[model samples]
Target: MKLLLLRNFVFTILQSGTVVGLIPFLIVEPKLNDMLTQQLKISHYLGMLIFTLGFFMMLICIRSFAIDGKGTLSPADPTKRLVIKGLYKFSRNPMYIGVLTILMGETIFFKSYQLLIYLLLIFIAFNIFIILVEEPRLRRDFGKEYLDYCKKVERWG
Candidate 1:
């Protein structure tokens, strides 16, 4: 159980780091100094708070997936059981929400227009992926249970 959790945590770190770390750093870091002007001071604090919240939310959701659903967030090893507890009870796609929140926080913190564009693109892509691919697959796999969960839960929160 410990090993499985460790593995899941590693995967989460890798996935989150790539999406919320490396990409934004590469794209936004160059303009960071200029962006972090005196005027945007409040934004910096707000962004950090949002980012921290998102990070913790993701961790909680990931742990719930591993413990309750018996799987990781990776598509290669998605949760076997439907995760309907924790943040999942509130949002059908809290992980995505978490990621998007992190990205939005990054955009605000860095004051990067380019990162904002990237965030929009990612949001659209995630929406399409969830609607077209994930929902259908979940419907097929979990049948009525997933549909019922959808009825109760908001897709984003």
Candidate 2:
């Protein structure tokens, strides 16, 4: 419905902003001149490609959440159904992987140890949140169906 889509849009924006938008870049400013002394480098373009893939992966997951699961990324408005399609078929937390991938790309591009540390912190936080919150809620909401999916899929594949 229109209402669900609207809510999804709003929450997606909020989460995306915090996870992959200006916040991280604000924290980790890359020096262009120092990024690579030599002219164009493969790692430079590779970083962009990785970033694009990460963003594309996120879009796919968000679409799956909305169309297939009737949900947003926010815990307050989680998926009504378990999403086990596309990337979900491989990993239970592909959205988080997408986020980490984006961060990884930024770190590689910037060559910033601060960003790398930030990525590690984010990963730890995500893992804790998933273990303490998301997984429990999924078990409560979807019960055996979710457990069965967990059996079939790798947690972080």
Candidate 3:
């Protein structure tokens, strides 16, 4: 149990760094004065609030995967059981939604059109991956139970 938790925690950090940390650096340099590239006039407070909400959403989904699914979110160490509790009840892909939400918040906060484009590209890629890979694997692994859950939950909400 301790080993599992440690593995999950380490993988979670790596995944979060890749998705929520490194990607942003590639998209845009954080700057106090983004006057040259600023495309939106979103309030700073609003951006922070959105970022906080996104972070919380991701945390909840990660916790659900660890506790209820008895697994980590990493593809190499995926859930052992089908998880349909919490945000999963609302969206079959809440984890993706949470990541996209974080990207959206970054877009607003950075006021970077490049970041916005990156976010859209990421969304499209995730949609394709879910449709072509993840969903099929779930159907195969969990069979009728997964199909039923798919019927109940929106892919993204």
Per-prediction backbone clash count = 0, 0, 0
Comparing 2 and 3 on lDDT, the stronger one: 2
For candidate 2, report its TM-score. Answer: 0.90
83-112: candidate 1 lDDT, tens digit per residue: 999889899999998999999889878778
lDDT of 2: 0.86
Candidate 3 per-residue lDDT over residues 71-103, each given as its tens digit:
888888989999999999999988888888888
- Candidates sorted by lDDT, descending order? 1, 2, 3
Residue clash pairs of candidate 1: none
Point out the higher-scoring one by TM-score: 2 or 3. Answer: 2
Error of 2 at 14 (Å): 1.0
- Which clashing pairs does model 2 show? none
Query: Top model by TM-score, which number?
Result: 1
Candidate 2 per-residue lDDT over residues 1-157, each given as its tens digit: 7887788788878987677777676776456455547565677678778888888898889888999999987898999999999999999999999989988888777767888898899999999999999999999999999999999998898
